[model samples]
Target: MTSDSMLREVHVRDAIGLVLAHDLTQILPGTFKGRLFKKGHIIREQDMERLLDIGKEHIYILSLEDGYIHEDEAAIRMAEALRGENLSLTETHEGKVSLISDIHGLVKVNREFVDAANAIEQVVVSTLLNNSVVQSKGAVVGTRVIPLVVKEQTVCQIEQLALQLKQQAEREAGPITVKPFLPMKVGLITTGSEVYNGRITDKFGPIVMDKITAFGSTVIEQRLAPDDRDQIVAEIQYFAELGVDMILLTGGMSVDPDDRTPGAIKQAGADIVSYGTPMLPGSMLLMAYLPVGDRRVPVLGLPGCVMHDPYTSFDVLLPRICAGETIERSDITAMGYGGLYRC
Candidate 1:
C-alpha cells in the first residue's frame, strides 16, 4: 500500500519524470522475492522494459505539492536526528533508513526518547530492545516517515522533538550506544568440596568455559578449590598475580553452611560490587573487583543456577562485563522488571 497521500496514475510509457508511489515487488519462487524498483524511484527510459516485464501496464506515483516533504527526504532527516554514537546509517532508499551497529557489543537504547520521537506525526523508528547483545553490522533500527508526503511543518516538528530527546538523553546516557566487548583473560575458580574432591562431576567448570568462550575469551587458568575460604583466597591471589583480566568463582554460592565463596572473595581483598540480584534462578549471584598492580580485576561468584539453568542473571551481566561495562549494584537492581528467567 502507498503512504498517506493522493496518488497520480501514469501509463508505463508516460511514467518518466514521476516518482513511484510504492515499491514494485518481484517474486520468483525459490530465486527472488524483493523490490524490482523501489518506491520514490524516478522513472527513466531504461526502466520501461523492466516495469513492463514485471506486469506493470500503469503505475501510481506521488503527486508532489508545495510545502510538503517527500518520504525519502523525511526519512533521511529523521535518521540524522535520531543517530547516536556507535550507530551507522545506510543511504536512504525507498523512504527508509537502517541504523546499524558499528561493533559487536551491547545495545543500550533510551526507550523514553524513542517513544517521544515515535509520538511525533508521521515519524517512525523501530529498534531492538534496550540492553540487547548485538553483532557488528546488524541492523539495530529501521526508520521511515509514515506518509508518502507530510507537511514541511510536520517535518520541522519531528526534527525539533528528536533534538530535545537527544539532548535529554545525553544528560543521562544517550538514545543508543554499542558497548564493544573486551578480550578478557579469565581465571576460573570452581568452589565446593564435592566438585573439588571429584565426588560430583565439575559441571560448572565446562559451563563457565563455554560462556566465556562464546564472548571470544578463554580460561587462562582454572583451579578447583574446596570451599575453604583460605584456599579460595589463595587461588584468587594466584590468578591475580598471574595478571588475569577477570576471575570466575563458580558454584557453592548458595546459603548453605558449606558455601564460603563469597567470604573468600572478601578475604582476597576484592571490592564487592553486589552480593545478590533480583533475577530468578540466579538471584544468589555475587560480583567483586580485586586490585592487581594498578589494574582492577573483576571476580564473579556465580550461583548454582549456572550449572543447570540455561539462562539467568549471569547471562545478562556477563556479556556486558565482557564488553568492558562496569556493572553496578543499581544495574542489578534495575533488572527486576524482566528478571523472570523461568518463562
Candidate 2:
C-alpha cells in the first residue's frame, strides 16, 4: 500500500537511495528484458549512470494512486492464482510476473479457465502453447495486471475467477501444470528402402534419438527396415518382445506407393489411435497402440515433416506421450486449432 502523501518526483542524479515508484525496463541490442528495477527497489549510486543512459532525466520517486492496488502487489496476487507444481515465479517487474518451469517436462494450460480469468478487467495471463515441451528454467507463462494502478476490486475479481477455474478443473495442481516425463526405453524402426539400401543416409534416426535423449529417455534398440510391411511388422514385434515402452516408425508415413508403415502397424495388431492429424506438414502422422499381453506399447509413425518442420504434430504429441498421457483422437484433433507450423 502507498499513501498519496509520500508522492514525490525527483531528478535522476538526486534519486539515489530513493525507492522506485514503479518498474523500470532495460533493453539491450536484439533483446527486450524486463525487471531492471522493481518498484520497491532502492536506488544505488551505481545505477545513476545507467539510468541516465536509458534517458531518465527525472523519475517518480514515490507516487501511488489512492484507492488502487500497486502494480507489484497486483501481479503477486494474480500469479498466486495460476501457479502450479513444477512452476516458480520470478520477481514482478512492470506489473508482470514471469512463470518459469522448474523442471524439463510438458506444460498444460486449461484454455477455458485462462479465458475466463483474462475476461476480468485489468488482469492478463499470457502463456505458450498448451502441452509445449519446456526445458528446466525456461520461461513458460507471464501474469500481470494491465494498468499501473487498478481498483482493488479488480484484483479481487481476478482472484475469484481463478478460484472458480481451479474448482472446475478439480485438480490439486490447478488449471496450469507441468507433467514431468517418466524414464522410458524407446525402440526406433526406420523404414525406407532408399535408406535401408546404400542409396541415401538415414536422417530421421539421429533426430529422433536426440529428441528422446532430451526427454530423459533412451533408444534401447534401433533397426533399419526396407519399405516392406512384413519386415516393419517383424521389427516392431521384436522390439515389443524386448519390453520397450515406446516404438517409433519413421520414413514410410506419407501416401506414396512405398509408404507401408501404417499398414505394418495394422498387421502387427496395433490399435490405431489416429491415422492422421490436422497439423500442416504433419497431417500424415500416425499414432497407435499395440497390446502385448498385460502391457501396452505406444507406437508413433512419423511423416517426412519430422525431418524439416521445426515443430510439427510429432513435436506436439511427443511430450504428452513422454509424460505418460494416453493421447486419443480427440486430443490430436484439439491440436488442430494451433497446428500450422511455419518454417
Candidate 3:
C-alpha cells in the first residue's frame, strides 16, 4: 500500500506543470474507453477542462522514496527477464508489456516458471497455452504489476526466480521460446482401392498438400496405393529411400478388415510410437518413425477426418513435428484432454 505522505493531491485546475502519478482512464459507454492521461504526462494549462469533463477534479503527484518502483518500470523488468529466443517485447503501455513472436513456429511455455513468477506479490505474467502454434508478430505473453507502484523487491524476486529456472535448465534464454519450423520434404501415399483404381477422384491429395504447404514443407512426391499391404509397404520404402524427412499415409487407418494402412506402416520397418491417439475426429491416427541411413523419418497415418475437419489430432501434432519435436507415446496420450471436437 502506498503511504499518504508519498502522494500530493491537488485540484485539476491547480495541477499545471505537475506530472501524473498514474494513468487516468475515460469511459464513454460504447464510444470510447482508454487511457485519457498516461502516467508521467505533464499537466498542461489547456488540459484542465478535458480532465474536469472526465470527472477528474483532482490528480495525484507521486514523490517516491527509496525501494519503490513504478508499475511501468516493473513490467518492463519482468518482460526483459522472461523474453527468450524468437521473441520481441512491446513498449510498456498502461503498466503492461507484451511478448511477440518473431517467427511462425511452436510456442513452448515453461508453466512452472510462469507459476513461480506469478506467486510473487503484485506480479502478473500471462502466456499462451504450451505447445500452441503462433504466427509472426503474434502476442504470446503479457507481463504487468497489479498496482500503480510496487516495492522494488517484488520485481527483484520475480527476476531472481526467472534466473534460477534458466540456470537449472542450463540455458540463458527465458521461460517462453518459439521454435522455428524446419522446411521438410514430405512423401504422401493415399491408400484405399477406390482412389487407386480411379473409381473416385482422389480428394486427400489436395487437402494433405494444403496442410503440408502451410507449414513451409512440400510434398515432393505422392503415390496412390490400393488396400494391398505389400504395395503400400513398397511405397513407404521408396519414399524412405529418397531420404524424405516425413512420410504421410492417408486413408485406411481404421480397424476394418480392408484398412491395411496401420499394418503396412509397421511392415515397412517403422518403430510405431502410437497406433492410435485419444483425440476425437482423429482417434485412429498412427504415429511412427522409419530409420534410414542414421536418420529417423517421421511417419504419420492420418485418418479421414483430417480431410474435412478444421482441426484434429493431425493439426495438433503436425506443427510440433515441423518444429523438429519428437512425438512420443506420452505426447499422444496427453491429447485426450481438450481433444473432443464436434461438427
Candidate achieving higher lDDT, 2 or 3: 3
| TM-score per candidate, chains pooled | 0.87, 0.80, 0.91
Worst 10 residues of 1 by lDDT: 166-175
RMSD of each: 3.2, 5.2, 2.7
Candidate that scores best on TM-score: 3
Provide the lowest-lDDT 10-residue window in model 2: 1-10
RMSD of 3: 2.7
For this target, which candidate reaches the highest lDDT against the unseen true structure? 3
Q: Sort all candidates by TM-score, best to worst.
A: 3, 1, 2
Write one digit per residue (lDDT tens) for candidate 1, span 8-48: 77899998888888789998889999988887789999999
Q: Give the TM-score (vs. native) of candidate 1.
A: 0.87
Give the clashing pairs for model 2.
Answer: none
Tally clashing residue pairs in candidate 1. 0
Predicted candidate 2, C-alpha RMSD: 5.2
Query: What lDDT score is found at residue 181 in candidate 3?
Result: 93
